[model samples]
Target: MTHQQILDKLSSKYLVKSIDEDVARLTYYAMCFEKDHNSQFEYIFPKLMLRWNCVLNADKNTVTDHYRLITILALCIHLHKYGFADKDLTAEALKAIDKLNEAVVLSDDFFRKSEEIKKIISSLPVPLKRKPSIPENITFYREKDVVSIQLGNRFYAAYIHRLTGVNESPVIEFYNGVFDKVPTIQELEKLNAKGRVYNDGTERISHFSVSGMKFLPDLANQIKLISACVEQKPPHQHLEKSVGLYIVMDIFKLQDEIKSIFKT
Candidate 1:
């Protein structure tokens, strides 16, 4: 799944739950922000300028891991307010601007000050580091070329290619959504043995921590089954998005926005 697609999948309220739900929503929103980073310049500027450098470091164990870091940097590098849901500070600030701008005439400094104040308020406690250069896959047959792989476009692969400085067109064939042998729900249920923290407003995960395969037929199961089926085969043998990397991207996006509120 391309970064956007990964985020889009995880954004479903159905996939997230528990303490992780907030994190997941944050990730989804941040992925959107990365797509159109400058659209809300007033909101994102503070993150880019102030906060991102601290948590992110260039070093990673794998191209997949490295790609994830960059995505997080892109997503959370800038936060606009305390949070993005419901009543975010940025929304309030935007409102403040609407009120101020409605006055018809004002000094350019006033507008400048608004921007300045936002920058200050949204500044990250520490600067985010630039993502490290992508390490070349030294292993033989690692398939350095993402295009050659049948897997569609998980964000990790694409982001890794970008980080490693690989300039290839996005791999879209994976999204056609086909598999050599689609597993039955019975088979899928067997594979749905693992669980992760979800920040879900909607009930998604049927299994709890260390719990047996809780039987909830939500998208989470389908997604995981697809992921497992794909993972069971060679990375080349499966579809791209089934990698399940998007779940992490979903959370990263939200954290970046939250960083904004903590700025000043």
Candidate 2:
């Protein structure tokens, strides 16, 4: 039987918690028991029935002897639960204890091997971490109500406005824009003429559609920048203290406005 199977059998009888339920406490107890199962009275007792205390003069040896008797009773209960009326419960439980001891040894060896392998891998020279090709900074160009975000030398127009009205999901559009100049009608016509095989043998550069995921991090960074700018109020000596306080309060609201868009 597996360690868990044996644990289940024992737990059902003694009513003590298993390693899975309380890993730290049970592991400590198991390690203590492995060292000298007879000497550990504090852990041997069923937690439901007996409580451990920090008393120096307590007869721990006697407690352990009593706990051993209770363990035998647990084995009998385990056997009875499995419909083994005539089985030698004491002998069977001793065998199970031997199996658990063997399992603990195997577990310890596996852990030791794992640690050695980790050390060996750690000693080997690792490859240098590569930097992302995309730049972190996103430049914003605001021309009236339209806001264009520049990413990787390419501009993308993004607008934030409610589609329906109050309590409705806002419409956020991020489409392609001109490289540096404001998109002219002639430039748009040039863009439309991409991938055309003319008799003069001229092909315009392919208009690559930008993926939303690529600009998402840059968009988040823009929101954070807005929030930071709002937080850092400009110093003014001419203003009254109360007026300055009110201005600070309004600036906090603006910061919230920046963050509120990302709440969903």
- Candidate closest to the true structure, highest lDDT: 2
Per-residue accuracy of model 2 over 72-181 as CA lDDT, tens digit each: 43433332222222234344444444454455532444334433322322232221122113222222321112233322223333333222223222232222233452
Best by TM-score: 1
**Clash count per candidate:** 39, 0
TM values, all candidates: 0.18, 0.16
Point out where model 1 deviates above 4 Å.
1-21, 24-222, 226-264
State how far residue 196 of model 2 sits from its true place (Å): 20
At residue 225, candidate 1 shows an lDDT of: 21
Give candidate 2 misplaced runs (Cα > 4 Å). Answer: 1-145, 163-169, 174-176, 181-264
Which window of 10 residues has the lowest lDDT sum in candidate 2?
A: 243-252
Question: What is the Å distance of residue 28 in model 1 from its true position?
Answer: 11
Candidate 2: what lDDT?
0.28
